[model samples]
Target: MDGQPGHEPDCKSFSYTSLQGGNIPESEIIVAKRKMDPKTFSQEYEASFESYQGVIFYCFNRTLSASNETVQPNDVLHIGMDFNVTKMAAVVYVRRGDQMHAVDEFVTYLIRQQ
Candidate 1:
């Protein structure tokens, strides 16, 4: 477990006995050690988002999967949008089978509210 603050509870929940001397195989124990300084490492790993730092998801990518493909006429298009007083943004995608393929994105800045 990490030695960072607030990680004490998580460290205590695991069975140290099993981790240290129990029936667990040495080969299966995945120990990830950091080579860099803690503060620098934390900043890069956290990517500025404290709450979602360590969580990994498949949909996070720079390039859309369906960027080169054409959306079929019958395909269902899904859009997710975020609206604020000064800014509005949206993501467009289509689902095929179990995977969601992003097609485009839109963003607009509002200078005046009506």
Candidate 2:
């Protein structure tokens, strides 16, 4: 009758659900993979914009999952960016205001010449 608040183990539910048989659907798997891949690309784009304007980027490589931070009201936040070649990354800090403010940021990436 007791288990982790949201992670209760249901023996009956598992009895008929084998790992192989209960595999995630192909479409779902693709979605999950897409979510995980090129994760930094979006961040890089935003960070680049901040850098262009001489703003400092603060946060990078942050968790995508929603948690306390995601729900909290805040005046500042960290952003992450990824390069297209898997060689660059960036982070930026942005503050809210009349026109939005970027306090600081950093960028680094490997240059692949083709």
Instruction: Tell me, by TM-score, which candidate is best.
Output: 1
Q: What lDDT does the true structure give each of the candidates? A: 0.56, 0.43
Q: After superposition, how far is residue 23 of candidate 2 from its true place, in Å?
A: 42
| lDDT at residue 35 of model 1 (Cα atoms) | 47
lDDT of 1 by residue, 20-44 (tens): 4556554543331134434434444
Off by over 4 Å in 1: 1-59, 63-66
Point out where model 2 deviates above 4 Å: 1-75, 111-114
TM-score of 1: 0.41
Q: Model 1, poorest ten-residue lDDT window? A: 49-58
Name the TM-score of candidate 2: 0.25
